[model samples]
Target chain A: MAPILEARHLSKRFRIPSVKRSTVREHVLGMLRPSSTEELVVLDDVSFSVERGETLGIMGRNGCGKSTLLKILSGIYMPDTGEVIARGPITPILELGVGWNPELDAIDNILLLGSVMGMSLKELRQATDEILAFAELERFANMKLQHYSSGMASRLAYAVAFRAVREILILDEIFAVGDAGFRERCESRFRELHSSGHTAIVVSHDPRTIKTFCDRALLVDRGHVVVQGDGLTVADAYTALLTHEPAAAAPTAALPEAVPAS
Target chain B: MADAPTRRHHWGGLVWTLVRTDFKARYHGTVGGFVWALLKPFTMFLVLLGVFSFIFASDPVYKRNLLLGLFLWDFFAEGTKVGIISMHQKGYLLTKTRFPSWIVVVTSASNAVITLAVFTVAIVGFLALTGRTPSPVELVLYLAYLVAALLIVAGISLAGSVLFLRYRDLNQVWDVVTQAGFFVAPIIYPLNILPERFHFYLYLWPPTAIIQFSRAVLVQHDIPTLRAHLMLLGMTAVVFTAGAAIYRRFAPRAVEYI
Candidate 1:
């Protein structure tokens, strides 16, 4: 199948300035002085694509640039050098509750968040009932988001994503939201999305969801994709790397593409 | 969705929508709620007028005219003060989605306009009550002042909003300027009363010219000569041009900082 999204040679580098202070006084006086600089290469020549109706997962440890890749793909942050082509209406659920207003009630936040997501007020009203019901937040719909537990906010956020007419769903480790009961609900909603042949890109550390929900996986070490092919092989490679032993040099030995040209 | 071709230059409507959301959120809680946008400024005008006229042995003509100038100046000062926080206030929206960055500045400036609309009623009503009826020409002059003032304030505020996102020192400086400007911008003093040497430079402040124009049309009942109107309008355009150039160039970087 033709790819719905493609990223090529994407690289993001960030400068973190530091002071080369000669004395403690200079370090303290840097507030009134200038400083030197350092740099971090967050994503180096990373590239991938997602086919229509396919679920792809990104698995990495913290600070492994998984979130940075997601941000670049979502168009939140432009890469230092690269380009992205998205085919359809892409919804990037990066940190589900980021759009919420603490002072506004759940209902008001629903409208506000939905509006930013490109839904009109009239259209949001139509979807409101389904969203609230799906979130199981009937009673707390009028409560301020700050008052709700983090889990409750997650449920509402999920409801918003599921109800939308999404062509590409970008998930940033959303499975860890809410309690066990809410997790079960999230699993069902996710399954419902996948079974309908929907397109999704999930960035997560959780092994189970990546294995169960995603048809393929990309394992990132530092800023490079060390392994990319099938889900099980990628998962095993990722786990092995974390175990401190050398990961399999060829995680996807079975896939013909994994073998070096002979 | 497939189409013949989608235009890339359709962010104006989206910017407008965000501006509307900002106006709603601004006056969300109050005694009269959003209506106070008009009432609060007018109340300040009346109280200032009362203090100057009733307590101080000030001339009635200058006092009333000065009140008119204060009304116009208040709009400019308060508009920019609130606008300086436009990007910072909407960090939640800015950090998440990547829409046109100018939406925050436009929204904040437009919200100030909503309050200015309220202050306007107080201005006209107070003028009518004071028995200073305006001729049609004078009425046109008042509107011209409002147009110029809004343009200048919107421009300055847009630039200021983006700047305030990075350096917060400007926030305190702005408050002090407005506090001092309320007295210095010919809001409470008469430019005609000052020497002719200061008169030309007094118009250097676009807002001062706007406030003086509003008073000339409303309280003085004089149809400012065409030259006066043209001068004010030209300066208004320049102020807006500078503001727009600064905002468009630098406002996009604000999202990165946020």
Candidate 2:
């Protein structure tokens, strides 16, 4: 089957200025000096494809460009090179409750953040009670978000994302934020979607999550895919990479292409 | 499914909900709530009205003109100023969601539209209190000019927001420009008080045409000349187009820079 999403040769580089110029005068003053900038290549020649109904787990260490790859796939940051072709609606849970107004009540946030997530107004209206009930914040539905605890905010955000789930979900370490109970519930929801054939690209540092939830997984180190195989194998590869052991160096050096999925 | 494109088309409801949230956010924690939106322009109206009225107590026409001009000026000034920084102010939304960037500009400006509506009612109330009936046709023309004024400001805001994303100094520069505009556009004084050579300059400024055209139709009860109407149309087109072009050019990479 043809893949539902394709990211071809994606690359991104961020230019960091060595000098800091906060004001117009400082900027002008620095113009007379030699200019220097360092380019941080976050992603380099990264290519991946996800078949319809497939959950592709993305595993990497910190600063390994996993999040950058997700951002590029979601169109938040246009890649420096290459392109992303998505066949269906792309829902990016890059950050939950991103546009939530702290000054507004929970109900208001449900409307604003829901619509911002591309759920139609009618859908949000219908899902309001469900979201409030799911988040277990129905009692505080009218209270401003500022008064809610951080955990409550994440719960509310997760509730909203749960309702706004689309054809293709791009999740970036979402499991890292919520509590244990919420994480369990999220895992179950992921299982439900997994069984129901929803395509997703999940970025996680947790090996168990990648191994259990994904059908196939890719291990990225230094912005390059080093291993691609069944979830267990890739998770083991990621674990080995984390232990400062070069367990997959021979395979990585031998084949630049992703290890074909079993 | 094929319904993906339709999902992107649903920004209208999103923009409206966002505008509503911002409208509430703007007034949150403040006493008198949205009344503040009217208070700034109305207070300016009162101060200028009191000082100018004492000087020209005999000429009620100038006071009324000033009252109306101040309303239009406040709409233009407040709308563009808020609109310019709106995109950056909502960085949370920009960085996190796949929302269209222009909606940020529109949502910011919509706040001013609400404030403008409040002042619009105030203007009508003043006309009634003074017992001077504006022509019905001219009242409609006044509404049209108000929309034109919004488009002109919205255009400037689009360009200004993008410019500000790159240059933080624009806020200071915008302050100076609006201050210069307040004095130059004949908000407190009548347009005729200025000499002919200055009239050419006024013609070049879009807000001047908006204010002068509004005064001619609403206050003076006379239709603007055809050339004057075309000039307003031309200026709105030029500013809006220029602003849209600038915004489009910068929008793709705006997230990185901002």
Predicted structure with the largest TM-score when compared to the true one: 2
Model 1 / residue B242 / CA error / Å: 2.7
RMSD of each: 6.3, 4.4
Candidate closest to the true structure, highest lDDT: 2
Q: Write model 2 residue lDDT over A1-262, tens digit each, in one string.
A: 6688988888777766678554455677788897666666667778889999999999988987888888778777788788888887777776665556778899988887778778889889999999988788999999998898877887888788777877788888757766677788878887787788788889888888887888899988777788889899998988888786778662332222332211
For candidate 1, write residues B4-43 as lDDT tens digits: 1122333444455566555545666453677676666667
Residue runs of model 1 more than 4 Å from their true location after superposition: A19-32, A195-197, A248-262, B1-43, B54-60, B126-141
Query: Which residue pairs collide in model 2, if any?
Result: none
Worst 10 residues of 2 chain B by lDDT: B1-10
lDDT of 1 by residue, A60-96 (tens): 7788789888877877777778777777666677766
Question: What lDDT would candidate 1 get against the real structure?
Answer: 0.72
Per-prediction count of colliding residue pairs? 1, 0
- Chain B TM-score, model 1, reads 0.82
